[model samples]
Target: MTATRQLEGKIAWITGGGSGIGAATARALAEAGAHAVVSGRRAAELDRVAADIRAQGGQADTLPLDVADAGAVADAGAQIAATHGAVDILVASAGINVPNRAFAELDTASWDRIVAVNLSGVMYAVSAVLPGMRTAGDGLVVIVSSWVGRHAVKLGGPAYNATKHGLVALGHSLNMEECANGIRACVVMPGEVATDILAKRAAPPPPEELARLLDPSDVARMIRAVCEMPARACVNEILISPAWNRNFIAPGEAAPRPARAAT
Candidate 1:
């Protein structure tokens, strides 16, 4: 079968599917012929993504809820599985990063919230969907981590780094345990991307700098590529970024490189 039909009739559940990488992945999966079920805290945004998929002649649905709420996350997965069949694909893209702060300046509340959403939320979603996948003996999971996941950085803050790092470990462990059941898992560590999340940064980068970052669609395409792979193979991890490397430089501190003339 062609890539377009690889996921025909499959059900894909994506958290934070209202925008950014989540929204882009939803579109990508839908186009590949899967029924995209998007979940997020924002009802309006989720509806918008669903509507966009439908407009393009693809299947789509919306579920609005906070991933940080463990009970709610589990319930949503259960309900979705019952109503639409087991989720053939689960993209745990819901995450948050507060403004960067020094370790001494970090407050307990901020750290708790980040861990709750980024770490607990991921585990909750995975646990909720794993049963169905195991019983069916097949599934794919894509966790959207970050470049900060594998390394320490001043701008990522302690909470962000810790949570992202946890996700990497979680994905690896999940892949190892579930491979026998025909379930595959991949952790995507992305560099700076142009998305609304940047607005939450302690100091948002300038427009020019942000423009140099990777586009969410780029990551979405990678997700599609992974999902389309033959069941015999699995992608364990991927690190994607723009051709220009700007993540090493702190936001607003680096000047844009001048464009070169065409040969």
Candidate 2:
């Protein structure tokens, strides 16, 4: 009567999973049969997600962590392994466009803030999980990236652009370097998802414009695809955007639209 979980018996760890794409992917992975560990700085939020998964009869655990801290990431990795086994899937979705201002307007402090979390934090996450994967003889690393990584677009600041671009290169390098070891690395670049990213960037959604953007569920489905895949076939990069789009728009002009009353 119950649907079979796609990743049954596999363990997964999702970073920046308090909300948005990471949170959505966490739920999707659990539905796919993975025992998912959702980690983030907010314990309460992660706990809520974990509880929901449990209520759905899926296995889940929460780890309150800051991926920017390598030590904490490593420790969390160990804890998850001890609790559910070595992770078969790792989703590096924890990031933000800190001080989302123009490149010239970005001071060194703001630049470092974005780089530390989006770039360095991903490194820490991958490194922390590698040992377990190596011991197990296989692993999958999924990095949630952005179209900005492919080619520059609006809101493309120095820090955000740099990290997104670097992630593609990182994913490729990992795939090639670890292919023989049965480790698959992939980057999911999704655009204009319905998530807190705009707010995180202090760019509010346009009530009218919100309808055109991609939803987090779309991105989550991509992550699920990567996670459910066999190591034999690797999806290197997924460049997704709003089915409809404009080259550019004012920051505030991207908000959601109000529903129309029926005539």
Task: Give per-model CA RMSD.
Answer: 2.7, 4.3
Q: What would the per-residue lDDT of candidate 2 be over residues 1-263, giving only the tens digit for each residue?
A: 16667789898899998898999889889888888899999999999989888888898888999888889998998888787778899999998875446866778888877888898899999998898898888999999888888877757677788899999899999998988888999998887777777766656656566668888878998889878777789898899888655445445445446799899
TM-score of each: 0.93, 0.91
Local accuracy of candidate 1 as per-residue lDDT tens digits, 165-205:
99999999998899999999999999888999999987897
Q: Backbone clash tally for model 2?
A: 12
Question: Which candidate number maximizes TM-score?
Answer: 1
Top lDDT prediction, candidate number: 1
* TM-score, candidate number 2: 0.91
Give Cα-based local distance difference scores for all models. 0.90, 0.84
Off by over 4 Å in 1: 1-3, 249-263
Query: Model 2 RMSD to the real structure?
Result: 4.3
lDDT of 1 at 205: 73
